[model samples]
Target: MVRWHVWIKEHEFLGKKGTSQDGFRDLLRASPTPKAVTGRNLSSEDLSKSSLQGRYEISRYAPVCLWEEDFSEVKQAFDDLRNRGIRDFRRHFEKHPEEILSFAGKVKINDVNEYTLELYQAKTKEDLLKGLEIVFSKQSYEVFKEELIALADGKTRFMSEAVNRTLNGEQIHILLSLAVPPGYKESLSRVIVCITDISAKQRKARELERIGEKYRKIFQNAIDAMFVADTETGIIMEANESAGKLLGMSTIQMVGMHFTEFHPKEEREAYRSIFEKHASRGRSLSDNLLVCQRNGRKIPVLFSSSIISLDGRNYIVGMFRRVLSPDHAQRHARAGKSLVTERKVSSHAKERLSGREREVLTLIAGGMSNRQMAEILCISEKTVETHRTRVMNKLNLHKTADLVRYAIASGFVS
Candidate 1:
């Protein structure tokens, strides 16, 4: 009778302890600092059911939690937990199996998702484009990609936030995440930006699209026979206004034609062979090409092709300008005449010197002193001077400075 009474009293005491909210508080107050402030509000995160490791193991005590004496009754109402795993009965009733599988991995998001950064001043969209242009416009994409990644890795001034005026006449914080993908530390840092206002992004995108459409209209109507060719295949994909005049067909018909069609009949094979060689090695090739005109007349043309990668495809942009030889020839003829005149003048100055004096004159023009010239020729400084003096008189150059200036103008220094 005494044992039965003691057991009944013990059960009643534990039942009351489990029912009280203050009971959990009392446990936390007892353990001064559980795991460096152990039983405190846990690492700020989404609510989960995992049993915490410290004094406050909420998952275990949840069964006897206030309104529910037995949580197992709420879930299984059957025997036990039985180490829930692959063959767990409670998990089998999940409405969508994939939804259960998704819980296996972390949600995986960048830390510090959004925050207010107090910039000294707010920047407009044009200001941002100017900064991006400094890296993208001059350098190739490959170089620019590496440069942005380097800046983000150092945590420099590249990544920052600012305030922007929202359409509602209020300021909102705009955040830019220069966050690397979790595992890709060595590759380029890709930024995923966040704006509090969704309408702002749509407005900017629409304005830019309008600008691109305007340029497209002009490109299609331009006078020059502009062709955007696939650099790898040499096939012309886009042809503009004057292409029809040259090919005796509309731009639609010429779209399927290869650039080799523009070559002369006999030189077609040889011309294509050289272009293939340059394209394979990623080199730009250009020459004065002869394109047979639509009227069966051969026209003299100057064509220049540059390799560009646009929309993830390599394209050869070819521009043709008619070469009026009378204009070009007159310019070339003048250039040739100047070349001969300079040569004659320089030749006359070189004539009044011995062979050894000419050697010293050549070295002096090459920006070498008497000592360097002597070292190169395996001769002494005194020997170099004797040669220099004789050459100076022959050239009427009294001062060394005058000799240098003459050498530059006469094309010897170059």
Candidate 2:
């Protein structure tokens, strides 16, 4: 690891450490909204306040070793443009009494050589630098460097707390947090530069909150109970208010409990198989075989799901609608689920089957016998059986009812 800067540790230049450091720096430099990562030009809706911590403090480390120091002992940053590159950077510190930097920069003049010490205050930055031209006549460079760092550190803390709470992707035009402390109370007399990426927990928390709100609207307003289960863990990740009512328990008592707990140990295997299939294959909406509810009642649930990302991990977001009585399907027709079901394709198995074979499968789902299908398609009964055999082999459906269900589910027919 080549040590280039005092604040930038040597590990930052190697393998995983390098990528991690780069990602973190990019994240901070990156806009907080989703659009930034997606490569979409950001509108005002997607914005976060990007600010500096405070006015810059330029300082040099005392007792500096050019080699082997992580440079954290003094809790300071360095000015390294003078060092120019890695080779020179190492020599500067190894030789002692020099500074190095990353993530921040300040103006420099040819004056203030390696051995001076000085410090002074000015009302404005312009005035400060302007006076530096003549005022150093009274001070040493070491004192000047310390006073500068202390002042800059004070500003850094305040700016860190200046928050940008983004709602959806709204454009934010707040103060630049650069070089400032977050608040008056948080002001520290001295602070070290923090350059790590530690913002995921907060950002992910906000994203999950947003998803909860979106799903809540649908679950609370929909005419059915909604349940979400984790495929890998087999735990109930989320369930809407109606889920408790459908499961025959109060909402408070039902949450934080596993879905499998309500089922017979034997039935869990079947449910797990289906869930894993959905998670791996990306099937969209599915309906009940059965999901046991509270009070030990097995209720038929119409299930639906979509793939979603949260906190940088993939999860299946789901909906569960109770498939009630005979009238429920009819009620759902008006509300949306039945109409959706009607569009199901019954012949997904025939998706890759030849046209002649598809004709046979469709006839089978339509309740036609082989002889009847052959007669209608103007083929011999033997040809109809051949097509049927091919269809079954491809779809792996040995039973007629399974063929009918597969067809209906994939919207194979109206």
Candidate 3:
């Protein structure tokens, strides 16, 4: 290509077509002026025009905003700063922010393509360049400081996200990439910068954040304890305040713990099986399950869970409510067992005891000691004993084993 351009120049075929030793030269003659040229008499103005023309050609139809700037003035100031033993441009600029503003003023905008004008809502490149103070927001100074630091560290290229304002005073987000031409790193004369508008992406991010905050409030304030775990890893991703309070720990302390850690250590396999089933089926409900608190007390809870998908990954959101009474646990347990068996307990026998008495009976059927029952039900041991005596007396059961058998027969526990 360079050879063809040289041939076109050598042949003085500026605006005429003619055949040459290289047949393609005849084809190139009819085309517009090529960007590259080589000759002893090439003036700087001619080179500048050629460079700007080439930039326009390359970036005229580009989607990103392109900027050709000269940082030679900023480079000289940096050199002066270095001579004064200032090595860290970032720290120095942080303390003396006015220097960055001064350097920004000295930096020159060489050229900007059509897209740059459109992005900044400028009708002409001159308007965009002259009104740079309006185009650059305060946030842009932070990015400018970082770029200066990169130049000080001998970096040839830098990229970052920043905020800039339009001519209309509307803020826009931009992904800025700045690079110096291969040999111009020290001189900082030919710096090419591109800005990709990311205002839409940032707006979407903020919308998602607002939606997340809304759901977060719902989760934290929910009456039922809630937990979210990764479907694949079974590691707890999040836990709400209710979950932490129910288990006697801070919500943050529950995150990163294995899903099975909240359940009884002795019942790990059973709870793991339940977790795996929920993950596979995308939903689950169960009773007769035990949750272990921080104090090592196991309490019965009605657990329900459903799977949710986000960003192509699946998660399980489980909600737990502590069983208020044995009747409640028995009702859930019966609902769960109905799928496997059609056996139903007599309504008369079920209605014989109150909810509290039925709960005592269910705990007794589960072989829980009176002290364990007190801890789980948040009641005194004497209160638990009283409920137990009432349960036996109301049923006319003479022995503890008889009461257990009665509870099983009534479809309260398996």
Candidate 4:
């Protein structure tokens, strides 16, 4: 044997300070061979064993319960069944479930992590294995058998939610994932199964679905019209039944259309500006707007709007209520003047005025200038001015404002 000099570094001291070379030599002599300064014995077998032990330690502390199962026996049984002229494996398995159950029994639980013991409330690995029969009932076994067959037919992985029972007979929902390691054929493979308890997650999902259904009913039956639109483009995303009825359009027709389409062409731009301003500042309310129906009727409406964040995007949710104008109320009132009577009264009051004069008067009462009235009535500005003069003279009004007051009082501009 050759003599070797080892200079033990201060950091290499395992227990106490000032552990000299002489003390290390004594320790080396006490052992059969000198251990490496790295604290591991130098041997090929020891290195391999340490690597496996490290992997085992990682698996033991893993968040999910890990299982290694041998499916070779099941694969052999499947081959035997196929040899017996069973071409439709699924139908055969369903009819002769005993064969599938027998093969399931052949699946050996080669190993399991410590988490498996904790999850199943088992005192030992042996106890957990013994309880596997009770944990997997006949119904669940059929479902598992189908996945197992798929896995054996070159499918490298499988995932599904499964119902399992613990040792205490408490059922748990588990998200199960099974995969075969690379370079291993399914027939001769060891499957690695990862199980995560998803009972709470399933419960939460069901609760959210229930809440969503409840809100959907409320939205459909609401009396006020509701619209959800894209904040950036003003495109309608969703409209309730009330909104469709109020706007005189079907719900299907309202979706994907621009929200501004329901307003008068002249007011669309102004409405858009106000909507943007309110959205930027959070929320806004307006009671002076009118929504146009498909029949060309402009109905005054009260609107309240707010910005809503959904799925990381901004949306505008608006609620609208029809506002009953004085004219609208008069039209619908039961004891009010009949249509013929109202028309007669309207004609009698305006008998002294020409059609052009009446038109100019209405436009003037609506705050239109001569230029606007001329453009709208398809005439010249000088002609509009002449009509205004005649209207003021015929009405015996001294000022232009007086003409407006007279037109309003007579319901000419309503």
Q: Which candidate number has the best lDDT?
A: 3
Cα RMSD for candidates in order? 23.2, 21.7, 15.5, 19.0
Tens digits of lDDT, candidate 4, 1-414: 000011112111121112323222211121222235277566867754454444445555666776766678877876777788766777776787666656666777777777878988899989988888556655576567667566546665666667778888988777766665554464643555677777899889989999878767755765667788888888999899989989898999999999889999889999888877776776534334789999878987656555768788888877666655566545444333333233233355567876557656766766777875564444689999988888766665656766655665554534
lDDT tens per residue, model 2, 262-341: 55667887766667887788655444456675556676654556655566655566545444454543443444333233
lDDT of each: 0.45, 0.43, 0.69, 0.65
Q: Which structure among the candidates has the greatest TM-score? A: 4
The model with the greater lDDT, 3 or 4, is 3
Task: Go through the candidates in order and give the clash count of each.
Answer: 1, 46, 1, 0
Model 2 lDDT-worst window of ten: 50-59
Task: Tally clashing residue pairs in candidate 4.
Answer: 0
Model 3 misplaced stretches (Cα beyond 4 Å) = 1-56, 230-235, 256-269, 286-288, 292-298, 310-313, 326-414
In model 4, which runs have C-alpha deviations exceeding 4 angstroms?
1-45, 85-99, 137-142, 181-189, 327-414
Local accuracy of candidate 1 as per-residue lDDT tens digits, 90-194: 334243333222221211111111121112121433343233223112212222233233332332222333334422335433332232222223322222222
List TM-score per model, in order. 0.34, 0.34, 0.61, 0.63
Q: Write the per-residue lDDT of candidate 3 for residues 262-281, one digit (tens) a residue.
A: 88888899888887887888
Error of 2 at 179 (Å): 7.4
Task: Provide the lowest-lDDT 10-residue window in model 4.
Answer: 1-10
